[model samples]
Target: MTGTDQQPVSASLRIDGKDAELEQRLDDELTAFNAAATGAGAPEPLSVRVTDAEGALVGGLTAWVWGSCCAVDMLWVRADQRHAGWGGKLLRAAEEEGARRGCTEVIVSSFTFQAPDFYRGQGYRETGRTEGIPGGHEDVHFHKVLAG
Candidate 1:
């Protein structure tokens, strides 16, 4: 037996106030951890949005860059705004902006029902895939070489 008995959390849960504090602590610790490996700090997070003539947001891409890689966290478009080429335009704009920020590659993920093929058409190559998600869809990872 161990020195003490411990109780597990109720469910897929976290200790109440431990969440943000723990995350922040890990982030702080990772600075030295990452710097030792990469010799650079994390990339600054960036967001790019597309709006209409009336200034309503229709689509956007959010990404971050570090070590010459732009990791896209989100790419979304309003339903009514889809297929008018806005998605592609927004993605390209994000890539161009990343290039300006010195990114040499782009990485993103998509569900099987999402934009995996669309990203492929945009020159991203599939790098990984996993199945058995909650929605029975596959998660696909892609990477692209950005033009200098």
Candidate 2:
């Protein structure tokens, strides 16, 4: 709609929650735009999973490689499998895959009560932290350069 000044008016916004179709549409459009703008093409999903002998899920990592960077979206291990070094193994696998995809670095984050120390132990350095999260915890960010 055109406003009184004869300019296009912005569409009305809503707060409806959790729309998967809309989410996918937004992701698709943004990916197309990013590829067109940056010439980096599309992001490649990189997942590293660990399982038991029976193929039961134990731990995994989900990340994406875009341009020269790999962004770790989530890394989780089963409660029964925690501290067994599966997390590190999953991360290393992801990093190796990211490197194979032409990424030179990886970025990840965790909550204060989560695996900040784990990432540190994996040679990730804290880039920043956002305080005032619920329960007085902070969301910590980390980065690591992949070895050649």
Candidate 3:
């Protein structure tokens, strides 16, 4: 055979037809896994009470205590008394209660629509975040150290 008698080296590309189908299957599996994981757990219930200087209801905070940490589940101030330091006062009170209960840390979660900056101002640091809730608002998580 002559030196030039050889097969042509043609460049070709082969695309996998199952690429899109595999991606869809993986997405479906992930979605099912996430849904199952979320549905397997329930939040702990908490009770809270608040009173004004005159012993009337003004604001309150609620939390679930587990070991050395407490999860602040809710906090509310009277509408008419907002932006007047009542929220901070209530938070401080909650901190005191947590400390009394042997809690070394207090954690809180709120959406972008809530008082993230307020918590930051009160010495809480953002520890985590999530999306896709409350019309895509970010769920901001915060933590604070309690006095022993």
Candidate 4:
């Protein structure tokens, strides 16, 4: 495998496809990093879902609590549900839970067309930016220091 100067791509991305073995291996590696940083075992996932009056799914927040930080992986509300305070409510819930778990900061990223401004409004300060990414938009990273 090392001597070949030219060879077909042996690895497949398998987008939207499940590779349980690979997934578990990656998780194990990441968890090791988490343990080293926090001595708190693996990163624990935190999620909150929103539903309509009929209990239909509408939106949710997904985060990983690791070390002293909560990494927000996804925050989404339905298009029709926008601008109704739901986004803020969900964000607060996630942040509160993180705080309760002794998390001292939150990290999240958003595309330019996404919630960069909203994250700023929620007290998240820009840590870095990647320009011209994923086409025309910039990707922004934010970090918030939680109040003790």
**Model 2 bad stretches (over 4 Å):** 1-6
Q: Write the per-residue lDDT of candidate 2 for residues 31-77, one digit (tens) a residue.
A: 99999999999998889889999999999999999999999999999
Q: Which candidate number maximizes lDDT?
A: 2
| 2 versus 3: better TM-score goes to | 2
Each prediction's Cα lDDT score?
0.88, 0.94, 0.80, 0.91
In lDDT terms, how accurate is model 3?
0.80
* Model 2: per-residue Cα lDDT at residue 112: 95
Best by TM-score: 2
Tens digit of lDDT per residue, candidate 4, span 41-94? Answer: 788899989999999878999998976889999999999999888889999999
Candidate 3, residues 8-112, lDDT tens digits: the string is 799887777668877979867875775577652223335466676799888888786655677888898888888988788878877777677667998999898
Q: What is the C-alpha RMSD of each candidate to the true structure, in Å?
A: 5.2, 3.0, 14.3, 5.0
Descending-TM-score candidate ranking = 2, 4, 1, 3
For candidate 1, list the clashing residue pairs, or say none.
none
Per-residue error for 71 in candidate 4, Å, reads 0.8
